[model samples]
Target: MNGVQLLLVIVGAIAVSGLAQRRGLQPALVITLVGFAVSFIPGLTRIELDTEIVLGIVLPPLLYSAALNFSFVSFARNFRPIVGLGVGLVVATALLVGVFAAWVVPALTLGTAFILGAIVAPPDAVTAVAIGRKLGLPKRVMSILTGESLVNDAAALTLFSITLAGVVGTHTLFANPVLLFLYSAIVGVAVGLLLAVVATVIRRLLKDSGLETVLGLVVPFAAYLLAEQIEASGVLAVVAAGFAIGSSSSRAGYQTRLQERQVWSSLDVLLEAFVFAYMGLQLRFVMEDLTAAGDSVWEIFGVGLLVLLVVLLIRPVWVFVSFGRHFLLDRVMRRRIASDTRVQERIRVENEQRIARGRRPRQFPVFLNWRESLVVSWTGMRGVVTLAAAAGIPLALADGTPFPGRAEIQAIAFIVAVGTLLVQGLTLPALIRSLHLSDPRQEEFDREQAEHALEVAQAASAGVYQRFLASPPEGVPPELLERMTQMVKRQSADAARDPDPDATSAYGEAFGTLYREVLQAQRNAVVDERDANRLDDDAAREFLEQLDYQEAAIVSRLGYRL
Candidate 1:
């Protein structure tokens, strides 16, 4: 498409996305349907890009942006489940779908079918994650879903590479399939870490917030390109870089943090909207390609639907069967513990000791209840990556022969991507609602966190005040100093308690300085809590934002730049 068409698509996407958000609907689902509808309008140009550009340029920043915001602590805590879904489930789905596709499509070889499998294997869970966040899914469930979406692309793409090489009759470096995957993953991670360190150091040395954020934009692309250049998984490289950079975000200037957050958020919306709309717009062209290739339209469409069904069915089946074993095993262990008094006493004593040391009592890892399992099982919505990978299929192999069933594969992939979005994306919110799922434990944990936050802030404020009393600023009259000190105490104590934005501050030059100091202390305390893992990353961020606002307000009133 030309520049004018691209501009129109973006404008239309944003407008529709705004409407969807206002109506409390999933913007992605709305955007896809609208794009599909718009595609039928006369004289509309079909938008297309080279598959490599789509994956290389578009995929990295989105994944990197997500990784930057994701909590490393949370990611590590839920590593097992994330790997299970991201890697294990993706491989299973690819193999299963590949076998099914080859069985049904007689013209396609096993290698090409596997390529199709890899294309559709990873579900873009952006929509699911967004809906879950809005509807208040538990933290762990959100983490698993988010982490799965982050990691699965690497797995699928790696498998795609291996299969693609096989189809093209090219020899890869690693003779062993397992060794190839391991090399891709390990090298990808190493590349990401090395780049993250370099980016962080450069940003720190730059010491300019705007420059830092601008550099932040380049980091993802650089990481992706660098990893791919070395035959590593660029997806993992981007993710690793994001995680590393995000964890060090606290060290950057607050202005940098604030600016980077808004930049990435806006980028995410733009890219996501355009991608879904692009998916919708291409349906007509995908069909045309298949028809032009002399394939039976109805037969391809039927295969698409069956493949979609397989994609949908395999997730819940895998989730339940894989996770259910652990659930059942835990039940047996719990029953055994109940029957043995000695074992029960030992566990109780250990937990009590842990609690006594100001730590949470030891508990088993998160085992999803039936409701959670159901919600997870149904969240498979294939999206941008699938379409990109499918369209990326080479037209000719190394020997200059037409790639087998390329058009058919793209058609089926488009079908599955659109089909899952319609099928699962539309229904997931309703399923979550119908189940009446609530994480009371998460709610209580948040509540306790809020209380702890207040306590920490209060302590920090008290310490600041004590320090001010101990050493008065030079050259202030005793009477004025006394008055300023009283004002500082009142404001510090009431700062967080007052939620009224309109409340006028009594802070002048002297009081403002003291209040800013108090805010800084409180921020430090919260950061410490976060570093120690005593606070949830989300909660820590929220508290830190409040402090930032307060500091900004004081600085603004003082006619100073933050």
Candidate 2:
């Protein structure tokens, strides 16, 4: 498709996806299936798009925005499992798949198979988080999935590079793979840290929300570009920079928090929509190769099955073995009994007298739950990175002939991606329900903590009001404090309300109507301003943009059509 046509397609896709999501369906799934259907049309079949443009240009922003919005405290607390799944699991899965592919596919070399393996290792953060959030999985589960998706790309890319080097005979696979890994990792980490530190310093000095937010955008690209220039994993650098910014900026203050949240939140939605839509657009290019031969199709299907089985089976086994070895069978049984015991009084007594006094209760991170494990397993749905890596594969062999299985590999990779995203993504909710896995009370506790925070904010505002009563600012109006006090109180009360109200019932309908009216009024005002010429071209555009954003936020939060 040409530029204009692509833009139109994207706009249309976003509109449809938004509508579908508003109707309580998965937006990614809708967009992908729609894109798949659209691509099948005769006129649209010949569209040529750049995969690098999608991955390099489009992906960095989405990844960075996701990392920025992720809860730093939750990520930190669950760092072990996140890292174990993110970095360690990517490496392990790649190695296992590489060995399998090499052994099974006769014409493919070990390096070539490793390249294929690495391509499919990292899952799409957008898809994983969207489904997880919709399924009402615990925040900890989302955290691990998000964290893993954020960083696994780096590991996959690193492995891809090493495999690439081997493919070109630039380096032997056995020759200093460790040094290559170390070099890329150290440089990426250093670049990310330097960029983050500089960005933090600038934020503190400027203290302007717009400027700080704008600077925050540059940090990710800066890290990515600098790391790439120095022959390192750009993805790793961006992820590290994101973690640094998120952790550091939280310590800055309320203004930083508010501004950063707004910036990332807005960026997140646009980038997410664009990335998934782009992933869907790839169907136009790969569909022909996918449908070529029945045998070829079976090979693709078999590879996808192997990948799905490996991803699902390996992680749980790894978790059980890892956790099991650390704790004895007797200890495991006792802990399980304690956790599952229906008699709260007896459990509490045992805990106080025997378990609490002398024996320390075994502690596991919140992300270690079976619910999280299932989500993590299902989340291994690959996207742009896999396609990009496969496309980047060199076309020629050592003897200057064309590479063997190039078309087959691309087709297989596409199948694996689509299968995981479409089937596994859709089925995950049912699987979670079937297992009777639910988030622990900790998530409810988090809501309460947020409520307390809002209360503190309201109390602080009231204290400011009292201080202003004692002595007001030189030019400030006295009525300002009263108005601010009322606003703060309303906000606090809203925050204190229960967040888990049944959405399909009367409670949801009540709040839904209230929010829908508020959004509609805001939208009408924007149109009125535009028509009345009160807001000029630029001003009206800005107002409309803000209005659209608020509308979407209200819809997402309330699950009500506007």
Candidate 3:
């Protein structure tokens, strides 16, 4: 597509997504279907992108935005399940799908079939996560799905490289696939951490919000390219960098934080819109190419439907087995702890010790209930990555002969992707509603913690105004000083009685430094609650965002950028 066409498609996709959202429909499904219908409108050119550009340009920012917002604490808490789905489930799904594909298509070799398997193995959970967020799915479920999306790409691409090598008659990148994966993961993490450190240092020194946001835009691409250059997993690199930067985000200026959030949020919507639109628009051309290659499009599509079924079926089985084992084990452990007095005493002592050390008591593993499992199982939808990987497949084999089933594989991949988006994505919200999944316990905990967090913030700011008044800054007018002292007294009294208190006074260029100090103190207190697990990360983040906005307004009104 030309530049004009691309712009038109993006605009149209965004408009469709907005309309779908307002009508309580899944935007991804609506956008993809709309694009497909538009493609058949007579003479539009094929919507295609270079595979390298898709992987390199389109992926990093989306991943980075997710990583930045995702709490490191939640990611670690759900680490096991994320790994199971992201790595273990992805590998299992690829093998099963490959087996089914080869059996159904006699002309395709096992190696080539595996290539198709790897390409479509990972479900792009972006749409699923977005739907869950809107529908009020449990926080833990959201974490697992979000974390899986981040890690699965790396796993799928690694398998893609391995299977692609086998089909192309080349030596594997490493003798042992396990070693290859480890090398990719380890080196990728290292590259991300290294770049994060450098980026953090530069961000601190820059001290300009606009410049910092510009740098934020650049970091994801740089991390991806640098890691890929060194044969590491670029996906991991971008994620790691995002996590590290996010952890230290509080140290950055408020304007920078606010601008970065808004910028990335818009970028995510724009990119996702473009991706689904491109997926739909290319379907016609993919079918045409298959026919030109002497492959029956209908036959290949039928096989792809079966592969899609395998992809859909394998996840629930794996999730149930893995998660069920944990659930049962947790039950057995709980019974034992309850039955044995000695064990109970030991646990009590350990809890006391942890409390003494200012740590939360050790939390037992809380596996998902069956309702949650069913919802998570049904959330498997595929999107742009699958199409991109299929497109990246080389057209010729090692001896320069045409790749046997290239067009057919691409067609199959597209079919599976669109099919899943339609079948699963469209129905996920209704499934979630039917299940009535709600976490009342977590809700109560969040309420209690939010109150405590508010108190902590008030306490932190309690002495700021007093300190300012006791030893007033030079050049203070007596009248203004008296006014400030009275405001400070009222704030103190309010903090003592009010559940939510405003501890900062009026803003002015002269008091800019004072406001900064007050804002910093409140932010630190809230972040401390977050670190201590007293406050939910999401709640803490929302509070932090308010503080950032307040500070940004102050800075803007002062006619200066910090």
Candidate 4:
């Protein structure tokens, strides 16, 4: 694809995304099927995607954007479950799938089968995470899903490397797989930390918001490349850098935060849409290769379907065993250790409402109830990571005959990825509806935010009023100054009372509506001035930026991020 084709794809994807958003559908799902349909149009050939470019150039920023939006606090809070699914479950699934594949296909060696397993093991939840969050999936569930997606790629990719080495005669370095994994993890993390520190320092020195965001873009790719150069896991490096930089976010200004957020969020949407569509865009090639493999289409699909079922079931099976066991054990031990004591007292108090409702007290499994486990299991949708790994598989073995069943393996991997997206992706709303998970603390959370907003508003207003009363600015009328102070007090107090996203708080929306009207009035006046030649175009633009900034601040603080 040249410049024009690439541009057309992006525009097409964006158009599809906009339409999907309007109809309450995931762009990845819609665009993918459409792209596949378009691929079959008369005389058009699909562009063969280079695995190196996809993995190296395209992946890091997407991963970095995901990491930036993820919360370190939430990740640490649900550390065990995320790690269990991301690393333990991934490794287990790879092993089981590899063994199963080798059993089903006698001609396929264990090593080659393992490569396929690793390729599809780690689930990508970019689409699910977005849709789930929008559908009001609980914060904890979203956090776990996001956290799992961020790290599982590193685990699967690492295993992919080890297994690939065995297949290609580079197995010497991976003789002890444990040491290789350790080296990859440690070095990746170290390099990530190094880049994060340097990036943060550079961000501090640069006052321009645009320049800061530009540096932010470089951090992820830099970390990934530097880590990969040293034979470490580039995925982990980008993740680590995101976490570290995100942790020090206080060092950034509001402008930088807003700018960075917009840029990364847009990139995430675009990349996810582009790559998923690319999956379908390459379907013709996959089908052609499978037809040439001397097997009926149905026969190949049978194998692919088997692999798909394994990928789908493996997650829930693993989750139930590991997540369930640890949950039960932790609750039992905690109950015994703190029986009738401080922690127990807190637990009882926390569950008092449930008790009042004639329900049994909740337990440690609250983080991932059985219902959540089912949903998470179902949401293990594969995206770019699986496809990239599959594409990276070598074309020929050491003897140069052709890697055994390369097309077959790639065909299966892509099928499972697309299949999972179709089955689980399409059914997610139904699953979430069935689960009916609710955030019991949502009201309390909103109340806390409202109270904090009030306190901050009060403190700032008092400080400003007191300071200005003692020493006023020159050329400022006393009446105007008094009016301005009074207005601030009124608006801030009203905003506190009406903090957004709480349905019960009508005042927030009311104030927001009025505030918007005011901004629009200012905008109208500025346009009038510009129309009358009282304001130059450049000056009008400057004024417009300020208005936009103010409007963004009000909306962001007074409403949900969406």
Candidate with maximal lDDT: 1
Q: Write the per-residue lDDT of candidate 2 for residues 274-376, one digit (tens) a residue.
A: 5556556655565454564223556656775776666556656766554455456546656776777675566667667755444434333333544455556
Candidate 2 lowest-lDDT run of ten: 533-542
Kindly list the per-residue Cα lDDT of model 3 for residues 280-364, writing each as its tens digit.
7877777888778777878888888888888888888988898679888998999998899998888899999999987888878
Largest TM-score belongs to which candidate? 3
Q: Would you estimate the TM-scores of all the predictions?
A: 0.90, 0.70, 0.90, 0.78
User: Candidate 1's residue-wise lDDT over 1-562, tens digit each?
Assistant: 7888889889999999999999978787788788888888898767877666778888888889989887888878788889999999999999999999999987688989999999999998888988898888888899899889888977898788778877977666687778878998899999999999999999899998899999999999999999988878788899999999988887776678878889999998898888878877877776787778888899998999999999999999989997789898898988998899999899899989988876677776668888999999999998777866776677788799989888788888888988898899889999999988867687889978877886877787777777776786665456666666566555554535432222343324556667778777888888787776677877887877777666655655563422
What local lDDT score does residue 533 receive in model 3, on the 0 to 100 scale? 70
**Model 2: per-residue Cα lDDT at residue 556:** 57
TM-score preference between candidates 2 and 4, better one: 4
- In candidate 3, what residue range of length 10 has the lowest lDDT sum? 494-503
What C-alpha lDDT values do all the predictions have?
A: 0.83, 0.63, 0.80, 0.74
In candidate 4, stretches whose alpha carbon ends up further than 4 angstroms from where it belongs are: 169-174, 334-366, 394-401, 453-562
User: Where does model 3 exceed 4 Å of error?
Assistant: 165-173, 394-401, 440-443, 463-470, 477-510, 560-562
